[model samples]
Target: MVSTRTPGFSRPRGRFTGRTRTPAPTSAGPSSRPDRPRLGLISRDVPRQRRENTFPPTPDRLNPAHLASLRSVQLLGCAIAAGWAAAFPIISDLPNQRLWGAVAAPAYALAGLLCLILPRRFAARSAAAVGLLGAVLVPLALLALQGRHQSEVMVVERSAHLLLTTGSPYLQHPVVVTDYDPYLPAMTLFGMPRQLLGNGDALTRVAGDARIWFALTFLACLLASWRLLRPSRDRAPLLPLAVLTASPLIALALAVGGVDLPLIGVCCLAMALAERDRTVGAGLVLALACTLKWTAWPALPVAVLLLWRLYGRRPAARTGLIAVGVSLAVILPSALTRADALREQVVRFPLGLTAIRTPAGSPLPGKVLAGFGPTGHTVSLALMTMGGIGVAIWLLARPPVSAIAAADLLAAGLAIAFMLAPAGRFGYLALPVVLVIWPRMAARRWSGKPPVPPGPVGRRPRPERPEPALPRG
Candidate 1:
């Protein structure tokens, strides 16, 4: 990188050789001219300064060695992920006795190893592309290959079939049964693909729908990563993209049927848009994501606060109001139809609490916090408070990142709270948490001032040798 600090600001070399002047000191004593200070107004007629001609060419995006190293690193990560997915038969098993764990195994392995080995610049771009493609293709493949194997994926298919074939909304009512989970409603909208396909088992249709959703979400994540990393201005966590893409939890969400992928994609979109100064868009995205899964609500506050920080309080307030107004316009209809049902599912059922059990049947952190109870509306409230504190401190120490990190960290904390709560479902939320840390763990390309190399102990900078004046000709 070229030095940002320009030279010749301190002293001119041979530029002033042809034109020079001497200043006389101000008169003192009896003839003192105090009003006219002896400040130098020296003039120089020299026009051919050497410093003016010095212009280093712009550097290439990345050196060949760097790119090669990144590729190797990514290759190794894929290998390890593949090995783990293959060797660990316990976790990699598919829902219906099918096992395509082998495919994911390599993809994840490559991701992990590349994260460790590749340089930040190359890794960020590569991981973004790979992660996005892997997220989309892997899920599609699983859904296509293993239809009706998983219960939720089956539910999604059945829901679509009931809607399409029977022309009945009752199928939608089944999703109401799990109102505590709003993702089903969002999934319902994409039944167009299933409508095209003739009567197949509910399993096949849902799988198809799911595959598309996963693909879309993956594409969103990929786009976000690319947009965030392309300019490479500030320090962004590249590893986060890898983690977001390659986490086993994400794979599990795809293998089974869950809202994690969609929520993740929306969250990413919101953050990216916010960074680009599209607060209204970010707010709408966050609002839509929250509708899919209440877990995304934390992002709302974070986004608002970030807007406030980025653009003064008044503008931030306006943005927040607009976002809320738009979100309600979109979500209010669905929520209204099932107002009583939603109340029973979300509020009365203590959907407000985090007593949900993990896959292994352990109480998530949110559950424990929920035990604190009535004082806080839900575990999200408590977790949000804690996460908010940490975020506030971080922002105070250093300004908030385009609000993306704030949203991400909130998600990570929420995931942890869910895991620690009495009934945390590790399957769906774990991936978001894992993804939140990816950028922090991975190195990013630096585009600021060039770094200073370590000098010998206690040694000072040596004086630059002055060039000898050319012989008079």
Candidate 2:
């Protein structure tokens, strides 16, 4: 190994260089800014100038008080989410995320409200779990049973059936969102149980619901991933199941549909694996995610670079080769089976390059620009593509050797992609949101020990000798 430090952790270091300009005196800044804690990111030490210039981070977003507070946040978030979820049915061309969230939201809010009302810490965590079943899970099960859910659930199920009967999951011509099988071949796995069981009775329908499967897969992968991440001596308790289950985005996804959830969970597992120097294990897990969607492909290279930095070339090489081979093994066959369908559905439809565009129009920067005209759409795509390329270049030049840094980099890159894609939605933001939050939640799981700082892997950063001039990228 390159350094004695555990594979999973890296010492936090700020990247500040000496030549950076000084900022105005802290005394002159806004009254509220003085007490605001600056969130540290990256491997190098931040200069005092940069620290002084930074804005106050959001309390709910990055620095919550505790797991109990997270439950409160979840419930309170659900309460406010009513406005957002209710708007989906009224505003969107399709009721995809749906009115179900409208119902689930308040239920979570009530859970949070109860905790706030009770004035006990344990009440918050314990009640939140009850809230999850009552507020979200019950509704989800009912929706699945009644077949009153988003079209994506059925789309995945149909794709699985097709994959079983035919060789590929996509259709020859898909004119609607439901018809388009934008997900890659591995996604068919989630729908297989439903296809085999057939929607005969309420029991089977609820049991075999693809949404249920998606939720299960997500929870399983998440628990397994975090278990790998926690230190052996310190057994940090995971973010409460109640809080995670009742979380606004998570609950909404469970109620409506979330093939993306499983993919995110698996990717988290892969990152955790890589952090522990389970080189081949990380690659295989990531490959499963990569085969689910093109969005997950970025994680592969990040994992490779991390392995190379810590475990050396041969392990990284093995991982890279295994991941690439596994992905191709599934992808190439599916593509060859229905080349035209795959191109039209997976590639064109998702990029908004097709005649029938996706319903993922959240009026985000990418979609707003795309709404202008073909030129605007092209510009949106180009910008998104550039964002991706820029991140790739940065990863190559300053590859993160630590798990948290890699996750942060991945989160930032994904956020840029979701923001700049010609077809994007609010729900897609959950990918980055979870990626950033998961690490912090993990760190804070133990009661007494201070949270682990993210930074450069292997060893403490050596003091830098002043350069003649900073080397150009």
Q: Which candidate comes out best when scored by lDDT?
A: 2
User: Cα lDDT for residue 135, model 1?
Assistant: 43
Model 2's alpha-carbon lDDT is 0.71
Model 2 misplacement above 4 A = 1-98, 232-239, 445-473
Tens digit of lDDT per residue, candidate 2, span 1-473?
23434342233224422223223222224883664333333223645444443322224344443434655555555566545555555655545355565565556556556765665756565566655775577778767767877777788899899988877798887766779988889999989999888889888888888888888888887787667754332343443545676676787777878777897788777877887789778888988988989889889988888888878998888889999999999999878878898888888887898888876558689989999999999999999989999998988898876666677778889999999999887788888877776755554332212234333322333433332343335
Q: Which stretches of candidate 1 lie over 4 Å from their true place?
A: 1-76, 91-98, 106-146, 156-181, 184-187, 196-207, 232-249, 346-399, 429-473
- Backbone clash pairs for candidate 2 read 13-43, 13-44, 13-45, 14-44, 14-45, 14-46, 15-44, 15-45
What would the per-residue lDDT of candidate 1 be over residues 6-104, giving only the tens digit for each residue?
344344222111124322222234464443222222122313242222222123244322443455555664565466556645653444323535456
TM-score of 1: 0.59
